[model samples]
Target: MIGPRERVPQAGRRGTRMAEHTGPGRSAVVIGGGLAGMLAVTALRGHFDVVTVVERDRYPADRTFRKGVPQARHLHILLSGGQRALERLLPGTVAALTEAGARRLYLPRDLLTRTPTGWQRRFDERRHPTLSVTRPVLDAVVRERALGAAAGPATRVEVLEATEAVGLTGDARRVTGVTVRARNGDRGAASRVLPADLVVDASGRGSRTPQWYAELGREAPQEVTVDSGLAYATRMYRPTARGEAPDAGVNVPGWPECPRGAAYVPVEDGNWLLTLSGVRGHHPPTDEAEFTAFSATIGDPYVHELLARAEPVSPVHGFRDTCNRRRHYERPGGVPDGFLVLGDANCTFNPVYGQGMSVAALGAVALRDTLDAAGGPGPGVLARAQRAVGRAAEPAWIAAVGADRPYVRGGGAKAGLGERLTTWYLDRLTARAAVDRVVGAAFRDVFCLTAPPSRLMAPRVVLRTVLLPRRPGLPRPPTAVEPA
Candidate 1:
């Protein structure tokens, strides 16, 4: 248990100078120890004298799955945009991930995507490189790096494992601290309040910040959700022989016409993860035989053909909490001073888009940059940081909502002229991207988070997408990477 006086002893030199300039006695409390929580600590390290992390689960000793993160068993990719942000926050992290057996897959070049129109041409521009690694490996490496950085001379960082944050200590005007209790199943264990100058909520999708706000007599932030009733199942496989697997991973995404999709991607240890997804009535099955059969129903048969040559090494696992939810914390009076919501706690996207982890990294970069600009924790620093976080999420949110709006039952609400026009242009652009390298590079740039979505609206891209004829991609999946 971490009390006001208790401090974890560790040593490092990364954030020493930054701590020297911080105001004495300033402290911060972060609620959660996952990637977001750790990154929040990274962003807060030099800004505070003491930083404490309250986590509900005990981390595993090795790079293995833990019960706290249920979605770890599925496929996860770190987009190029996220990769750069993560490296910025913790230098050399991308290299560390690659050294830990994570495969680097260049966008379009290393991934075979079946767009709504047809198979996307594999462009070897090598502009966007994504990291494909198991969630456990990714989490473990990040945890090790963050904890190391936290041990600097200026800020003292401590993590209380098997502990949960229950409520806030302050009222609606400003957040002052957090109330936490041990998770050891001791009914008589008393709760304690850890006072702080700032508090951050990075508790992911199951966050209880709203309830905490309500307890403080403040209205919770307004939330908007667009759920496509998406559900997915995953299973692990290994090729029967070495080098038998394809050089590139497979992606067959669902379209309005065909609402079933699948992705077979390579992970660490030469293992492959095959995830199948569908909306509402077309949810994929978890049964071994049914899971294999459903693969044949996606937009293309390439993924199914690959599945036939591999041997299953794990039982099928299913997950269904895929929804696009955003809490409007940037709105006026939405959050109190000295309090912030970040990562999935503020905005969660449909997992099929593979944007969550990347967005989290980008949000951390925004937080760090905002703090540096503000110089220190001043009167309106946290609020400004929160708004910066919201801005970081906007591009991903727009992309997700646009992609998912069509799948919503009854088409949800009627779109206005601007939205309808944008949708029409995007549909045509998607078709052009499948065959046009210039348009495809622009599309990947935006989607990978390396550039703003405005890149897609550039005159060159717009003219090509709007003026050129739509050409079909390769009728079948390419057996080898095509030269640029």
Candidate 2:
């Protein structure tokens, strides 16, 4: 357990009180050891002398599953914004992903997508790139990069595996540290408090920090949610030795009226990661034949076609807990000093948008940028961090929930005049993007988080949306290729 005596400065500083806490000049403790936790530690390293990452599971050295992360079996892709932020955190991180067999795919051109409007035309090239890799491989690479960077000459990143954070240790003024329980080989448990100047909760969707805040005499934060009732089923397939395999994966889009969607992405080891998903009543099945039959119903047949040539490596895996959830940390009365939430703890997306990892990376970048401006961690740090997480995640929440509402149950929002007008303009923009490469690229940029939603409102793009030639909606597959 870490205590006040363990708070000595690393190499660069000489201090007594300065080494005691992260505020002004001190150390930080981050709860959770997944990608978000590791990223948060990397971000806090420069400002804090000692950074500790605590997790309930023992982190593995390879690309394998552990108790805490269940989403590893499904399909996940990181957008360009996430890649760029991670690269900045650990200089050669992207290169490391490539070395570990991640597929670095160019947008639109490499993506064969069937949108509700029609088959999207492939563009020539792109300024932004998205990454395709299994969840475990991606997590492992990020953990390695961040943990390495956190161990720099003047900073320290300590990992406490097989440990769980019980609650916050401070009162209303600020969070001093976290109380944790560690399990030994003898099945014995020991509890203690690890003091710090700053504490970050990156414990993901199951976080109990709200209760901790209430314990400290603070009100709970406000929250908003759009539960689309999304469910996902995934299967992995390896390439056959007899035929040459293509590098690109296929996507079959859902109907504006229906809720089903499918995507096949190529990842490491010459394997294809396929996911079939639906909302509410149209949920995909787990049976092998039924799963394949469901894939045939997508707008694009390419996913079904590819399944014919590939062989399944694993049984179908499914998840149904995806919901668009957000906590309004920026609002008044609740937020405390020395403590902040990052990644899924602050906001969780529908996941179909593939924004979770990227948003986490953006959150880490925001934390770093905020720290740089403020000089060091202090009373206002958590507030500023809340703003940063909000800025990083709000656009994604809007974009995902915006498109998703028309199809899911209770899709309509508090339909004010401004909301109605904005929705109308966005619908027109989506219709135009079906045929225009320039418009498509711009739209893809926003989807990938390389740019903001306001970029679509620029005069050039707005003119294109207003006076552009209309085209048929996205195309359906030529024929329904029944999966084998």
Candidate 3:
């Protein structure tokens, strides 16, 4: 229960007295203790005296399942772009994950991917690196490092587990803090407010920032949702040894022609994380028999063949909330001072693309950069930070939304002439990449987020795309034994 002294009046409405923190603050409160929340706290530590992360679930002592992050059961790969951002933010995060048994894969070279167009030919020396680890291992290592950094001099970082934020405590003009309640729901569960000079909502896809805004008497940020109706079912397996093992990683793309896709990724402990997926009416089933059959429906059958006899470490896990949901938090005057949103809360992409955590890391970098340029945390700084974060996520959003629009239901914005032309061009480029190293290198850069989408539009790439005849694709997955 909150003491009477702790309760403060909301900032009220626009015409009323506002509670704007015109300068840097002593404390900040971050809602959600997931990756985004922890990184948010890290971003604020240099600018604030104290920071606190509130999470609804108790922190697991080991890398095991927790109620909060149900989607951890699926496959996740850290793109090189995300790796660079996180390494910059937390320094040596990439090495740490590698040391934890994560597979450090070089793109295309180590991957036996089957793109929608065809099999992607491997190169000998591409440097686009990706990390594959179980979600629990990734999250635990990040948590440990962030908490350790907080314990250092100059700032205080704390965590309050089993606490759920119920509402915002301020008005439309400016946000002051968050109102919260214990998750245990004990009989004496009186609510309390966590005061702050700034508040960040990094609560993932289930975020309540909109409701909190409405409670503050402000208009909710406009939203855009493009759901492809994709459902994913993943199972963990202690893969077979040596010559019989599947490729390091594989992805069968999903499009209208074949709405089913699957991926086999190597994760911690030499176990393989395989996910079977189907879109719209073809959602994958969780039953073991049905799951195996669904894998066969994908463009390729190698994933199915690999999993048909694997020993299971866990039952099939399903996640269905795959949508490109972006809240327009950067709209002029639409966002309140001292309030900002990032991570999946601000924009959630179709998880099939594995962009959520990576985008979150990029958003934290954007937040840190914006705050540093603004000199510190204050009223206008959060607004600017929100806009910058949105920009940071824009590229990934464009890639996911554009790629997914064709598979989504309902009336979405029709593809413009430019979009249709670009799609046609990319189809050829992907085909050309099957045998051309130059095209493959450029494609890998953009796909891995190391380069912008505009990289594909460069004059040299454009000339090659238009002039070079695409070589016929390999007849099958490029997993044949490499020459000695």
Candidate 4:
């Protein structure tokens, strides 16, 4: 918990080392300059003397999309758990984001959310308040803070834009640095190795750590991917008056019968981001006419009605290939010392769950605790840190994979008894939650990641779900919130 204005450590160049890092002289190299990379920089404040963040794309001014991140145009909102974790790392970050036009919202109350079971009932007050903003805007604000530009003294982190990590520099036992290339096609400039005490492959979901490890004579980490084949079609629109549904966000989650989903999120600048999504063979279309029609395939058409009135600002954008990918770095022979991976590099969730960014923030916070426990960054601590990061991500992973497991199996691989029982209980919980305020609030806590999924399985919750008769599904979207 260093002050905002503290003299941040400035690490100097330290080359290759076979032995583990001892006392001080702490330094680190973070590959990838996205939200995870920035937060990692912030977390390394007290522990490292020098930290370098190497990004492949040159960042633009403000919250504009960078070249490397194709999903920046998609709708992104920070879950409550992530927001709190971020604020803990960099104070005033939440205020900075809100000042930049990101709105904080209540979970089921502020949004018209139709879950797998039914519509979520709104309440006058709730604890889970999530932050809404475009991916680019969120990245920019966090980058500014992590780079020492947001009210903090000159930080230890140095940004090397237009740079990419090509390979690990050390041997199989331990990693000491990384080989990098400037994205600029300078044939004359040869590839160079940047030395460091530690290296982080936060290079994202497409990270080549497996290949790099293979080249270093180490076994590749076990990779688990559950591809539900979910596709996203997003289009930006001018804000339209709520009229009947006075909600800040609208979500219709897809279920088996209605295999389609849709969401409308209020981003900065009075704009709206509406996305239509589906799984496997039932992907949403990008055509204007078909996109609107796809909305009907979902549970409700309220989102379509609202979009019909709003003016289109951006063309329809489609993103496919969203799969839940989890690399088992915690397994033996999975990770090397003095090197670790976080964020999408370690685990990539199905974006439809909206847990990626939140998990990333949580992983960063967990990294801080791991570093403190290890008493500084070094070879001895790298594996433990990776395990801790994986632990922090476990809850989100379970929620996402559990929900998506049924979809991908396509009537073949049936969900185990545990999953079946869990789903049945949750579905009942959702039905009762629509009419019950306390139940709704508790559900919102798990949805927003403010609490663990185990809360839904509590004796009280289970008993209520089992004893109470199911409430009638809302005849329509819960457009108007009744004052409680």
Q: How well does each candidate superpose onto the true structure, as a TM-score? A: 0.94, 0.89, 0.91, 0.90
User: What C-alpha lDDT, on a 0 to 100 scale, does residue 204 get in candidate 3?
Assistant: 90
lDDT of 1 by residue, 1-484 (tens): 1111112221211221233434577899889888899899899877888888888887765678878789999999999999999998999889989988898999798999888777888878899888999998998888778777776777877787888899998988988899998888897879999998999999999999999999998998998888889999999999989878989998888988999999999998899999999999899999999999999998888898888789999999999999989999988787898899889999999999899999998898899899989987888888888889999999998778777877877644455575566667778888898888889888888888888888989999999999998887788886666676
State each model's CA lDDT, in order. Answer: 0.85, 0.77, 0.78, 0.77
TM-score of 3: 0.91
Better of 1 and 4 by lDDT: 1
Ranking by lDDT: 1, 3, 4, 2
Question: Candidate 1, 441: how far from true, in Å?
Answer: 0.5
Compared with the true structure, model 1 gives a TM-score of 0.94
Q: Model 4: runs farther than 4 Å from truth?
A: 1-23, 149-155, 187-189, 240-246, 410-417
**Backbone clashes in model 3, listed as residue pairs:** none
Instruction: Compose the digit string of candidate 4's lDDT tens values, residues 87-141.
Output: 8888889998998889777776787777655576666665777888888888877
Query: Per-residue lDDT for 227-252 in model 3, tens only?
Result: 88899999888765555566568878
Model 1: per-residue Cα lDDT at residue 315: 97
lDDT of 1 at 454: 89
Model 2, 12-112: lDDT tens digits are 22222222333344778889888889889888877888877778777564567776888889999988988988887778989888888898887666667
Give the clash count for each candidate. 0, 10, 0, 2
